[model samples]
Target: MTKKTPSLISSEFFEPAKASEQVAPKETALEIVARLEKSLVGRNPANQQSPRPPTRVQIPLWSEDHRPVLHDLVRSALFTCGQRDARMDLKAKPIYALEHIKITYTGEELRQRDYDVYLQILHLSRGATVDNRQEWVEFEARSLIKMLGWTQNSRSLVELRETIRRLTACALEVTRSRTKSSVPVVYGGPLLLKYAGAQEGGFDEVTFWKVQINSEVAAQLKPGDYTRIDWQIRTKLSPLEKWLHAFYSTNQHPYPMKVETIHKLCGSRMAEIKFFRRAIKAALDRLTEVGFLSSWQLDDTDKVKVVRSQMLTIQDRESNNDVRT
Candidate 1:
């Protein structure tokens, strides 16, 4: 026996529309076609309202001489301390933190030096917009190297160029680890939108090379949201020391953090936690030497305690040493 295929209108259903009950079958078909045509026309790229151009994202010119580091960047390990090859995972990785200073990163491993390079780029772009569209900043890379107090020789120039390339290619996202707070800003952007330079000149030509900051990043640059650090002091710091400075700069009232958490915070690649402790000790000492920290020590609880230069150092006399690495 042959089987019948199922249909939208079953044979077992009620009677069809009578002559008087006719729903104007041909007109109904026409109406359906018209409705479908309307829908397809509505979806057609040309028929719908032209998409509004992306609104001009113009941030005010930041006129400070000090380097403006965003809290989003300063508090997290988006830029790592160690020279280890940090993974290129596109998924956001949770950065270890205390209280609610949680941050997550999504990008290639950014080094400590990348932070400096990016900040310098930000510095250059500070004068770029209030009405600027391109957001391009011009500089001869040799001068930029010297501005950062880096050597201005040929080799160093090439290294700086490569650094710019790396930063331009890499993107990152920094968001609060928790949403309990009223903070609404979450930053996500590449270090640069794009850059133009000659391989031979290394941005040292008469037509100087230029770099553009992504508008998304620049839109967040405003007063009261960024920390201004002394560029001279930053230039003197090592990779790990630089990371330490930024961390402390963001925390006005410093609290003792676990050595292990800090290890994860800076994205340290030290195979052993003990090695990170030693490096951290040396880094804190450097910070003290540079006057960013008045003093820092590990307590018996294995948490790092730090006193800033402005804060009075309350020396703890009862150090029965449990945090010594």
Candidate 2:
């Protein structure tokens, strides 16, 4: 039996690195705000706009001691925390909290637009709470929001707002948890310290900063706990999803592979083949939307005749070489 290679590529492949380079590194939140303010003034020069205070949300997190840690002044900035002995690739985790998460233009027209965008930055950091699963769990967004008794909403707008609030709270709780879960400078799982000195410092005071983990402490987590870390949206591959992705990644040879041939190659039944056919068709539709693939509908006759010509070529090559006598 041949082993199948993993087909799921990293999400980084979907994002254009060139687009990131176009953005400036030194641009400040204040500068962006100024530009927006100027544009608003330019559009509405009549000086009839009413002054409304900037909108903000205050989310609360529960510390290990059952005390509420409050981020009194949340702004458009980034925050991060990490395990003391985390692997290089998985060390630092960051969260970006947006200042003007929503825009409410309340005068002649009542329109609200969500502008909240925050990203959690994960990295290796030295902290009292470094490498402690219990502490980290206490700081995760889902768990923290649950602790805060926030209600979940199904609408995208409400979900985005709720997500931002919980994430901000998670950052504070995670950072504080790091201060509480102290692992020793010597790497050991069980002997790892649970509480680091409150005075120990490395995290940045303002937003958009990084924290460091100690060299000695290893993360005290079960293998299963690795899946629960606070990261971006990741989906568990269902069996069908796996097969569809795998088939595309390996068969770089242009399509028109016969459905029967694919079934034989995968050793699948008619029902399974039908499933893959539909899956591939849907995937192709999505790829077309993202400019990755081009496709067209074929008539019944064309569909029945489509075959892998490469397979036919190989069969002919193996069968015989044309001889001119």
Candidate 3:
């Protein structure tokens, strides 16, 4: 009798271990206020206009974390946490979150793996000419796989192609607002404009693949709007840890939030809150272990308090530029 072989691609594929946090140890009263003020300004610049492009659109350093603004907001549920079902791809789903935001995701039920692929595509686009038509950032598949930290193999390559297709096929409709009176801004569109491999053959036969960043989403990647994820630390976390990392990364100083609320916000599939609560502590612990978090814990009231370790936040970077002026 023939037996089925177990799949090697799992969230653990990217799970490795590491540690450190950069919480500012000492801060004068002035610095505290400065950070807070900067935080508020950096909060959500959805209402602001896109900055004018320079003569040459130089791609920022690949090391910088230029995440999609919508992904950052819907992160709690944008990519489902825990192990994913192999068959659950290309399905439309609604993620319930705070009233201030509504995100409609239609396409592949993105997993953490897809998250890497989407970001990798964007990172590669930094240097490529970008537009609505998949002026896809081009590259050789083997090198791209190695960069994603995936094992180089035919299966990995196949998976990489699917990852890109998933990214290409997805559409996001995100609505965000700071307050009821303030005008709500609608943002988002297809996560990607289009994508394809070199002609004659599909991904399998193409030596170079092209992936584009939806021009609309690419605009939001302006300086203050995006978060800088520590890829080294991020690559080492579990699905839950990665989600939590993004949720917290968007907030320079995370406030106390109910574990229950987080479970809801993260769009957890775990049927019970109690199970998610238990799982959360472990995930938070992983963040702390990896230095993405300074410290975190469930308090007596059941609200989790998180302190982040950041060498410099987007606000901090802008603040330095101001001081130089």
**Most lDDT-accurate candidate:** 1
Point out the worst 10-residue segment of candidate 2 by lDDT. Answer: 106-115
Tens digits of per-residue lDDT, candidate 1, 210-234, equal 8877777667665544556667788
Question: Which portions of model 2 show Cα errors greater than 4 Å?
Answer: 1-139, 143-272, 294-325
- Candidate 1 yields a Cα-based lDDT of 0.69
Q: Residue-pair clashes per candidate, as listed?
A: 1, 28, 3
Clashing pairs in 1: 102-177
Model 1: lowest-lDDT 10 consecutive positions:
316-325
TM-scores of the models, in the given order? 0.71, 0.19, 0.71
After aligning candidate 2 to the native by TM-score, how far in Å is the CA of 159 from where it should be?
Answer: 16
Residue 18 miss distance in model 1 (angstroms): 26
Q: Per-residue CA lDDT of candidate 3, range 1-325, in tens?
A: 9998888898655666344533447999999998987787688685255865643333345454443333334344677664665535444466665666667778767777677777776777664544454344778887778777888777777787777777777777777665689997677777767776763344454446876667776665656446656777777788788778876776667678887788877667788889898899999888988887898878899999888787775453542211000
The alpha-carbon RMSD values of the candidates against the true structure, listed in the order shown, are: 9.6, 33.3, 30.4
Local distance difference test, per candidate?
Answer: 0.69, 0.28, 0.67
User: Candidate 2 vs candidate 3: which has greater lDDT?
Assistant: 3
lDDT sort, best first = 1, 3, 2
Cα lDDT for residue 309, model 2? 20
**Residue 43 displacement (Å), model 2:** 87
